[model samples]
Target: MSRSLSIIWLFGLISGFNIMITGNTLNYWLAKENIALQTIGLLSLITLPYSINFLFAPIFDSLRIKYLDKIFGHRLSWICLTSIALVFFVYILSFLNPFDNLLLFASISLIISFFSSMQDTILSAFRTEIVNKESLGFASGIYIFGYRFGMLIANSGAIYLSIYLTFNEIYKIFAILIFVYLILLIVGVKYFNSFNVIEEKTYSSHTSSSHLHLSLYHSNTSLCHSRTSLCHSRGGGNPVNNINFIKRYYNHLGKSLSSYILKIFLDSRLRGNDIGKSENDLSLLSFIVLILIFLILYRLPDNFINVMINPFLLHLNYDAFEIASVGKFWGVMGAIVGGLIGGFIMKKKNILDSILLFGIIHALAHILFIILKIYGKNSTLLFITIGAESITGGMTMTAYIAFISSLCQGKFRATQYSFFSSMMGISRSIFPIISGYIVVNFGWQNFFLFTTIITIPSLLVLLKIKNKLQQ
Candidate 1:
């Protein structure tokens, strides 16, 4: 790879890592702080602001960051600002104890989440600008790997550290780590300047709407000619004059509209060879139900596990350290490995097939939890169950990520992906709340069974989209 591409990838890694660290660590820490389980679900509300970025992406496309785009450039400046803000916010959070000041902690977390979301938007747009279409899948893999590693550090490493240190200390250490990431991001901003600038200018000019304006002007000319033709046909001129006018009108209208529409569609290219012959080919509306089913069902087992696992551990008389250790070592590591493997497989295999297979494996993995529930909290069983769940979950996640990436067109990649990812966040956020209720009312075993049943709809959706996915 070129030096600029390498820098872009590194920035992606840093951003991914930063995002995951908080996501994985916060839950465990929140529970340890004695917050209600229901409130933990509400913590996902912090990400709600990110949903607006999708709505405003077109504005980002049109607006420049003033001299910042000329100074540090567009993508880099936004990324740097957001990264610094995120680091500052996280550091501030290190000082507040959630127990004494729940509002303060919640406020800081929301701020961090907002900055993190903006960072993600800029970083994703930067990646789309720098990386070639062919490299997107591999780039995504690297990102997920880095992200999962961060989770490992936060979930597993932090838990291990907590055995010897206080939660406040761990927060400070990770805050320092976030600062280190900020430094790396600054370096990336400098390194990527030359190559990314060229691509950005090229893409920007090509996707500009000047051509569309010209096309509309030509269409207006055609409409004028058509009016003239009608006047001639009403005995104002010779028949030949009428025919010539009508011919010119129809020809100009056809050429202008066709060219303009074609340009609009072709502006956002897809992954494969065939470009924009039909917009419907790229539309996911037909599969909205499929996507909904996939989201709800694929995540059900994990959601149930998330809700009940901590309480179940508490009930089994396992301490926070043990649960954190197992979750970090087995769960985090397995997810990273599975994500890497899934990304690799997607590079060669059909995405739909991969999703189906992983979904099936994920559904089957729930059986391990049932076994664990029956056998009761042996460390070995806990590790084994977590490992199985994480691996399958990772696989499912990787496939889903790749599938969503494939669905996005070049122009709207960031916005479209953000929308889809936010949908995922919504499901993830809501599932836990429902799972909490289920664990309280239905109990753990029945919850797992319900999760298994939910997987059926996702499987059917996979079948529905199988052929299109292969294409």
Candidate 2:
């Protein structure tokens, strides 16, 4: 990856750490003000906006202002807008005591949360779109490394600060980091601008509206369902009839599909372009679908249990420091080690193989969490299990993110990667919402066992697309 790209991916530092900020700062501030525990329970709902950011992702893709693009560049304009909003609103939060007016505080918190989430969503796509293919593994490693580091910084620093600093003082310091984020962002833009990212040319033809300004070259392409081939008939030829539908359909049906629906996405990745083979791109339709599937199912089992980890630890009567030692402190160290290892491995092998190997490891590591249920009372065993699982999970996730970066194309990466990453957020919310009932009905042992099973289909999916990805 270019230095610019690598620096840009560091936004994961802020994104990953935001979780710690929200959970810690909110709790500390509320307790200081003597707010009801019940009010705190309601405040947790402010985070819901993060889960559903995807519903609004399409707006970024479809809407554009020519004037803004001229000044800040295409994606940068939106990034700047959201970052400004995030800083402004978060700084505002440092002033209001939720104890004084819970509703308004919650509303402002939600607004800040929305901007933070949007910043993450936009950055995920921006990083994917601009990053070089040869650097996908390296870039992903940098991201994972930075993100894990950020987690440690947030958890360790914020928690420590609460002992000395007031809630407003602590938050103001966090708000200042956004300015640092903006500075790093500007530096990245400077480096990125040195290269030719988007190539524009003038033409007599107009799209949508007439102006001296012409948009980036985009043309209508089709899924070509019947043919199962991405035929480039841009600007002139028909999507449906240009290809020999009979021949295409027969050829498509000739292959034995492991899963027709899933395989289509892979097939398109092997063939799509701007109506032609430019950089050997995948069709937007296929890229979107592949990301969606991977996002929703790839780590569904992990996320399902991840949401309940704190409660599980608490149920076992572990202290916050103990949890932090195993999870945040040592966990970050493990993740950093894993990310570097994953990067080196990806250098030696194809991204697909790296993904396949680590993906399985990630799934199998869940068994360690189940072991926690059985040995619920042993801190020594807890230390070992949590350490082992956290390390393995970190290794696998770095590789998994490399896989996600590989799927994104620069053309509509903002929309596509946002959609993919958004589904990941949504699944965290969806599975956890029902998790209480699952644990109550089945008990922790059975619930964890089912979590292991939910992972199987994702592995099966990886198997189905193996050949297509090899293309």
The superposed Cα distance between candidate 2 and the true structure at residue 284, in angstroms, equals: 15
- Give candidate 2 regions above 4 Å deviation: 1-12, 19-81, 91-109, 121-145, 160-173, 179-295, 342-360, 377-379, 402-419, 440-443, 461-471
Tens-place lDDT per residue, model 2, 216-333, is 1111221111111111111112223323433443465456433333343333343243322332234534534554676678777766665556556656776556665765577667
lDDT, residue 260, candidate 1: 33
Q: Taking the candidates one at a time, how many backbone clashes does each contain?
A: 0, 0
- Among all windows of 10 consecutive residues in model 1, the one with the lowest summed lDDT is 210-219
State candidate 1's TM-score.
0.71
How many collisions between residues are there in candidate 2? 0
Deviation from truth (RMSD, Å), model 2: 10.8
Q: Model 1, 251: alpha-carbon shift in Å?
A: 32
lDDT of 1 at 451: 79
**What is the lDDT for 346 in model 1?**
58
